[model samples]
Target: MKIACVLLLLLNLQQVRTDLQYDSCGYWTYSKGFGLPEFTERIVLNDVTVYYHDSSLRSKMPCPDWINTTAGKEEWSSIHAWSVHSRYVSALGFQSATKQFNLTGSLSDQNIYQASGCCSLYPDGTYRAFVTHAFNGKDFLSLDFKRKTFVAAVPQAVLYKTLRERDSATIEEIVAYYRTRCLDRLNILKQAPGVLIRKVPEVRIIEQQKVGSITVTCHVTGFYPPVVQMVWLGPDLQPVDEGVTDVLPNEDGTYQTRKSVIVPEEDVGEHTYSCVVLHSSVPDNITRVWGGGKAGGMAVWISLVCIWLLAAGIGLVVWWYRTRDAVI
Candidate 1:
């Protein structure tokens, strides 16, 4: 009887261990063999969802006052550095999010980069997002976790309500509005077959420093089939004579273009500069400017020349008045 009791106790203990193991391993079983980290943060905005994965799970928590916290600062700094060092991550995230959310009306090879964290307000009070991972190259589909459901925040819920509305406008309507309001009317004249304006080009100012003169270098990309004319524009809407160069083609067939602008010491603070591309598509002209700065060199020079001409004219007027009095 003592031996039988001992056997029964051992059997019960083994069953408890098996149950615990099954519970813990349940989450891992659905992972599909992908090696994603244990900690994950999923953010859903409107019809779009973004998942951020971190091996340390630091990014999984709510970032209340994230801008003021050390982790926030570190993330910000790392993003800035990443923007310079490995911008491919940024590019991939943007492309993936837009496609995943079905934001673009037509399925084309163009990649759209949402600088505002994958969330943007639509005309019909709806919000759209392009979700991505916070880590260097992580993405939503790349997640190896088995959990199918995630918690939704208040803002995310609001976005969901907006997207779920049936009366919301379609992407075609939005594109039509954009075409009429933003694009140049003259572009209609240039439209033809095989002259597609694939994707709108984007310009990102990577580095700006004043080594005697203000030297500005920018990263430009996101156009398909390339453009015949890509130039830098000044604040006055005139082209600058900056040397433009094209970077090597990425494996995905998208090209990275760049242009450098050198401003004289005196005119560095005078005008703003922008990267402009002229494509053969619907929006024939696309421009992207840096966050803040005065107009470019062309604008400054033209303004200065106009001022000098005005001053000379004023001097001539005074001389004419004095000469008239002498003749009298």
Candidate 2:
């Protein structure tokens, strides 16, 4: 459960930089009807989580020596206290916001609030960053660096923008954090005693013979960074039409996904079909070909596989947990 909280936190991070080092942090709270809200705080460096605190656990999640996180008790306590205060304030905010929008929902409907910030640093020593917030899974407000002010993502958020914009000091503080603290953390992570480990994607292919066609499935797993590209290649080495599944998170924070295509029975021996994967972890694209000698030698069965980065709504993560349909 503790580990799940960390993985679920990944849902808050909408997009990840494939070739940049980043320091991103977010505090998320989930509530439903009258139940006490559950809160989680997370710090991610280069898309890998280094620090995590779950309100239910009441402690920072543990990490191995390779992922060294040196946060102290004072930091955890302060974040926890802040989360508690946030839960209270967010509850009131949600009520008023819902009323203002004339939105109606069932009592069982869930509510979520999150404040997330991220800074991405390039090799050339330049950085881009922002601090943003969402309420009930909609973008409420975001920091505009150029104007040094808050902007509303929707009409419903104009009230928040007006309120925060009036507080120039708060805006300055957010910009300072983005420019200094966030980027500093990225630098520290880049120079940490233990460098970020890159786990290459393990690729394999399985074929299932049906009545008039054969289905070839390329299973890629055990990869880090959670960003991967997989495509089906025809015998001519051209991209082929295929069905790809969502990237699923492994317990160890790695990811797995599959791309499958069907081969006509008559064209089975024509040539070969391949699954080519591109990811940051690998120096070159990994290709797994199906057909030829392997076609003759058969395997009876093949075993299977973050489901996040869900922009627009982080509430999907809350729903997955609220109902145990699927739990990583």
Candidate 3:
């Protein structure tokens, strides 16, 4: 049972998604297996990384791009010292955790542990800080400053949280760092001039012909800040049930997402089906329609699903920003 718990921990260990409102946040993640622990850190201002450091580098500070560096030399020196101490603390905690659970599995078991923290400053002059832990690859516990307590994400965390809450002094120290020290760090990092860039998404409607019904997918791509909403609306703009895909990051720092819905083939021309997208980068809502309207006609790149439909002997039609291809 102990072995299975740690194995599950490793399997679930990945970065937790951030739900912060603003982008003045500093993210820290420390992970270790059985070697010299690896420390990775990045500080972002307006979604731009102003500072980055990792254990792989011998130097403490990130190299300046021959321009004004993020922070002063003295600051980097201080950060380096702090990060070094932090790495050991995290590693030691890993040791203590294993002992607490009586995990005496073979060293070949290959274990992993991660501790992450985020401190963000909202535009309304409000700020929030949170720290979470994961073993193997699953969330273990979280700190709730409002309740002044630890919130266990999983049942395995209940014992850990109960034990941790007994130490109020350490809890207070954690709160102070997030509320005061962390926010002050963010203020200094945001002083530099920033470029707030935006990119509007290119929306496409991809249709797949099935035996009795057609699967239509709305693909929204090339958007920034990873914020957008897509919905399939039927006639009269009534919301239609749809299956949504995960929002994935692109290599260019933009984002792509998809929402798909299946409709009867006979109903194609009987009712209007449109995909509506709302995003910050877009001034007005962008709508792409199919059936009972002019299908958007443009020389856009064909989607893979359309290609698959063509090869499968079924028919396909693609619509764009204004224009249509008819189902065969």
Candidate 4:
């Protein structure tokens, strides 16, 4: 089983998708694997990538109480050292996760890293620093700072242990490797896809009736970069805030999404509703209109079906009359 796992890991290493994301919060680094040939069966994109943010500084932005004093400003300037140490805290939390790791069969696994931290100057000219790794995303391991421990995962602990035993690694050494080597590599890997790939989405407005309730849905599909927005507009041109689904992955690596609003039965009228989709690639918002006596209402479908039946009936009547006359 162990040999098989190693082989699979090596096989998956042919392509890498290293995500180096840095927002207003802080910097993060992680590596992921995408298998070759059948690129659809990606591993790293599916795995949980770990990132830690120094919310301590962000929480006190635009001159917090800590920065009021010169001493506090000095501590803040040296935050890089603090940030590196915080990463170790986050890794410790990764090692402490309790989730079971599958060894033999399918390699789909979930990994969590805790990411939160704090550094403050004490009254005796001493610094009391503690880093906690926790985030708001689902399955992110949380650290109880007061207790100074993390909830460990079995797979994470095993990996950490193996690395530690291999090199007699200390916390400081491991943290340095992550900051200097891992993150730098990630920065390079992130730049591999130089040009931003953008695809304008195909948007359409549709109406669905179920249990007497009509849902006006805007179906948006076949887009790249996945960043998109859909908004429903009333006939008055005001924006209607409806729920939109997250951009989901398509087989071709494009994205698809949907947004919907429930229209009151009485309010259904010709040209009463429209959906507008916005994406970076689109020069203008794609507008799809429904209702207001348009082609996408339940009434319109019923009318079309009736019209087809009426035409069929007329043709049958004409044929029968001709045949009867000939027989007489």
Error of 1 at 301 (Å): 19
lDDT of 3 by residue, 1-328 (tens): 5434322322221111112334554445555555633666666765777777777887766534433444444445555666765566456545555655566756525556567667754322446667888766777777888677989876766776777788788788778777777765665555544524456789998988899998888999997667666666665445676655689988877889999888887776666676766565543456677763333332111222222233222111111211232111
C-alpha local distance difference test of each model: 0.38, 0.59, 0.59, 0.44
User: Which portions of model 4 miss their true places by more than 4 Å?
Assistant: 1-112, 115-196, 209-213, 292-328
1-328 per-residue lDDT for model 2 (tens digits): 6334423333332222233444456555545543643665666665655566655675555434443445433443444455554555455556545655766666326666666777766322446676777777778777788689777777877775665567688577657766776655565555434334557889998888899999888999998767777776565444576554699988877889988899888877765676666665644356666774444322211100012222224444444443553111
Better of 3 and 4 by lDDT: 3
What is the TM-score of each predicted model, taking all chains together?
0.28, 0.65, 0.63, 0.37
Distance (Å) between predicted and true CA of 149, model 2? 1.9
Pairs that collide, model 2: 249-306
Alpha carbon lDDT at 90, candidate 1: 35
What is candidate 1's lDDT per residue for 1-328, written digit by digit as tens? 5434423322332221111100000001011113543222232222112223333443333323424546444543433333331233334444445544565554433333322222232212222222222211232322111221211222223233233233234333323322332122112212222322244456677646676776776666765444335555554544566654755564555556777877666766666665544433322234455424655556555544533343344435544544454310
TM-score of candidate 1 relative to the true fold: 0.28
- Per-candidate clashes, comma-separated: 4, 1, 10, 19
lDDT of 4: 0.44
Best by TM-score: 2
Candidate 3 stretches greater than 4 Å from native: 1-57, 62-78, 121-126, 147-174, 180-198, 206-215, 236-238, 280-285, 294-328
